[model samples]
Target: MEWSKITSDKTALSLIAIVFVIFTIEGLFYASFLGEDGIINDVDYTIAEEDAQAHWDEYKAVTVNVDNLRQALDNGNLSLKLLDEDVSIIIFESDKADGYYRGYANGVAANQAEFSFGENAFSCYVDLGTHSYQIAPSWDIVDNKMIYAVYMTDYKKEEQRHEEYPIDPLTFEISNEDNLKHNISIEVFNPSSSLIFSEEYSISPGEVIVSPDISEFLGKHRYVVVLDGDYEFEESATVARSTGLGSSEKLYFNFINNSEYPMEVGIEVA
Candidate 1:
């Protein structure tokens, strides 16, 4: 009886030992196959996330560049005339938002301080949408005026007649009957900000004088005519200065003869 009991007890112990081994193996298998490796498997997943982040950053950069380019095109192609006291730019992005953008001439002052426009006349605007920023650029002139042909030339002291000059005379006149004056000065400039010529002269009222010496000023150059009086019909004068990509070096007629008599005129190339 004792021997049988010992045998049974040993057998039971052996069975328990086998079951424990099997459970240990199963636990290891579950940890390796299901728990550790199953959650995130691909070796390249981290790299993929990095690549996706790079691509997203590039897309954002491109979006910003496109926005800036759009603004530049709008400012370049469309010339805004500030006849009204103020003009506003819509900043709601779509009409659904409540924000507003504002713009005005704001009267030009000599800039002694930062954020000030320096001795410059600019058309200014504000963006109230994403940014509380200001947009200011050199102003331009557009108004009602007749077109006249003025001649420009370089005169050689040796040659008395217009036929002697080598360069072809530039003979386009700006017509402004109201800006009648006793004295007139004509200027021509090149894209390089070089002054081609600055000449002073006098003309009779209601007279269209073709410069006897016109051959010198005609070339691939922009011309400016400064007369000494106000326009006949309008109290203000219009000036179109500088022809370039952004009108960066542009100026407009700011001189109104507040003086009782006429003013002397000079030309500058910038």
Candidate 2:
């Protein structure tokens, strides 16, 4: 040994080394014995498990019944009870229904169509003896009221046969300018709500229909038009306003019958 540089307390140094070793071993044991993420409380773990169970229970409660689909098919109107929930409907024959859904002036009656419901909406096709049309109800269901129902038939041939006329773009603009606005909120209550056409945009002071062309929206629309704020409209603006706004007047549209046979009028707006 190099005595000149040797320490006087070798025993003390050994003791210090032993103490360091003991601390290192204890730290390793603490880490390994704890949870993989270093969490070791049983109660906290149990709470997480319970929360997962609750989520599963809620999901099961909301699951839709397939029988409701069958009921829609059996009923020509694709009906549902407003007992306590909102439902969705989808028409099986979309192409055939689309023609009448848009309120075509064709003078032919169609057959009652078929439909199915999903999580929150309902849609159907109306058959007026010779034609099939699409109809979608509103997303919401109000108890005891058949609002937002879409009917796909000529107004002149239905049970409530009325005088039918072409929906003049200028006349429509005048009738609804008071309520149409940039931002709109709509609430539907019936299967035919799909027939209603309404759009809101905050582009200016009033509302406007995004697409006013007849070919684009031909079917019956079932929708509630809600303006974002109270508005005062002038006569000049009436022609420029959207389809869902204007004076608080009831605007009626007509479907001209030009097809080969007598037409049937379907109910969708009311």
Candidate 3:
């Protein structure tokens, strides 16, 4: 017989063959037990599961509530637009409240607006009231908690009426508690609706001061202050000048807190 190649002994060759057969059988058993794709596939499946969990963790649910959609029925409209492909809401008054009708402004304001957006950023625009402007609020993802609150109303009714006055240096001061850390921005717009001055400040713990001389902008200017903090904020500001209105010193703006915080403003005409 042509002997199979073994080191020296036929008995040793038989034993080696037996050992090879046993190893082959063991390998087949292991593979068939977990199927053909066994350990590698299990590892891949675990990685996929982990990735899906991370994706769900990052996803956020955002809501926009236009409180007074009925106010825009006569003149304006309101809408919410999500950057994603699945959500939108157009607001109109479908139901009555107190004495007024209010609901989603569907066609008049926008097309499709919804309360659920599984993303971080979206736009909420309200074209309500008799004012000739746009009031669009933005949403952001802050601290892994993604909830945005918005209140829409008639601009003519909600805007604070400010008496025209004069001052040389426009002084601004913002105060917040120690637990708050954010930014506050101020913008000065002229009567022709041009941005004359704009500045942003980083606020951490205490009070900050911002003084600007807007001597060139004479009459009917706007001051828009925006704060992005997490705690109670108190805004104190005074225009340092002689109290009088001339052709070159009257600044008039309805201060609107359109930031991401609940703001309270106390204005004094000096």
Q: Please write out the lDDT profile of model 1 over residues 1-270, one tens digit for every residue.
A: 010110113344344221000000112211111112121111101112321211011110000112332353334221221211132232222111321122221222221111111122211232222212222221211122111111111223213332432233334332223344555566654321234566766655444444333324222344554444221111111112223321112222222233432322222322
Which model scores highest in lDDT? 3
Question: Which residue segments of model 1 deviate by more than 4 Å?
Answer: 1-168, 173-181, 212-219, 229-270
**lDDT for every model?**
0.26, 0.26, 0.32
TM-score of each candidate structure, all chains considered together? 0.21, 0.26, 0.28
User: In candidate 3, what are the lDDT values of residues 81-153, reduced to their tens digit?
Assistant: 3222122234344323222223343344433232211223222333322322221221222233222322223
For model 2, give the 10-residue run with minimal summed lDDT.
17-26
Q: Which lDDT value does model 2 have at 107?
A: 31
Which candidate would rank higher by TM-score, 1 or 2? Answer: 2
Report, for all candidates in order, the number of backbone clashes: 14, 58, 16
After superposition, the stretches of candidate 3 with alpha carbons farther than 4 Å from their true spots are 1-167, 229-261
